[model samples]
Target: MEKKQFLYMLKLVPELLDEKNWTERETAIIGEHFCALEKLIEEDKLIMAGRTQNKDDTTFGIAILQVDTEEEARYLMENDPAVAKKVMTAELFPYKVALYNPRFTI
Candidate 1:
């Protein structure tokens, strides 16, 4: 049997992100968010997570995950310190990986 999965798009709260810099407080909160994601990665719940490098207001983060359902995905996103703290918001979507390195396949 195969496992179900979904792709989640996490957008940084534009207002929270300084175009030029992040406050000490913002940095700490972001750090906690990263740590939370790292925990998910270590647990194998998250497949890949990264942020866009556009350096513009549209920049945001992305995470591909293998989970049972959208509800589960939302649960994970809601628990992220970034989201819970209003530092970021997320949009969930169904995704299919058409191509990838074989070694990285589940």
Candidate 2:
């Protein structure tokens, strides 16, 4: 099957913005989240993942992925460590990469 592109937008829980609210468990989950995304990149399932620098309500992160079906896309999004543990909420969307800049690096 051919893979399709998808993206998941992630919003951090408001409480997480305050460093004082960070517990060891919460910090661990975030570490796991990064590991998971890194694994996806190794698998060639992830195109890119990044977030805004702002520390406000408007802040968000996005993960772009290529997978075989919408179900797979949704599964990846829901299974993201941050989302699964409720540190972040995520919404999935079908996406297309209309252009690329070869020099760009995250």
Candidate 3:
């Protein structure tokens, strides 16, 4: 039962130069998005996910996903609160896990 998986890069909406500070509403949306991602991880759909740490740039997040097809990966991204709420946009790509520690296997 080896299903093909994909790697998706989720890019957050670029912060406005004038609006450098993140509003409370934006913070809330990100929090909810993380919660949703946590649930996906628990369900074994997401192998790993994390955000970029570049504070002075257009920071984005990356996720390793397990799905039956690329279409499913697109659907998952579209349904994510971050994307749905306009906090982020995503692009999916077929990927192969060439090397990794067994403890990190999905």
Candidate 4:
């Protein structure tokens, strides 16, 4: 099947920005979130994933994926540990990568 690109943006629950609200469970789920993204990268399903440095309401994260269908893309986004467990919420959108610099790394 041919693949299409999609992007999912994630926003943290307002309380998450305050370190006082972090419990072991929230920390573990975040760890799982990173692991999930790593797995996607290894499988070639993820093009890139990152977040803003700010800790305010404006802060957000994004993951760009290449998948066979929107349903698959939604599945991936909805299943992200942070999203699944409600540590964060996400919105999906069809996306196109208009330009990229091969040497850029972060």
Better of 3 and 4 by lDDT: 4
Which pairs clash in model 4? none
* Alpha carbon lDDT of each predicted model: 0.80, 0.95, 0.80, 0.96
Candidate 2 residue pairs in backbone clash: none
Clashes of each: 0, 0, 0, 0
Q: Which parts of model 4 have CA positions greater than 4 angstroms off?
A: none
Residue 65 displacement (Å), model 2: 0.4
Error of 4 at 23 (Å): 0.7
Query: Where does candidate 4 have its weakest 10-residue lDDT segment?
Result: 11-20
Q: What tens-digit string does per-residue lDDT give for candidate 4 at 1-106?
A: 6799999999999999888999999999999999999999999999999999987889999999998999999999999999999999999999999999999767
Off by over 4 Å in 3: 16-19, 102-106
Q: How accurate is candidate 1 locally (lDDT)?
A: 0.80
Q: What is the lDDT of residue 92 in candidate 1?
A: 81
Least lDDT summed over 10 consecutive residues: which range in candidate 1? 14-23
Candidate 1 C-alpha lDDT tens digits along 18-94: 65556777778889989988998898888788998886678888888887777888898888888888778988887
In model 2, the worst 10-residue window by lDDT is 97-106
| Ranking according to lDDT, highest score first | 4, 2, 1, 3
lDDT of 3 at 65: 87
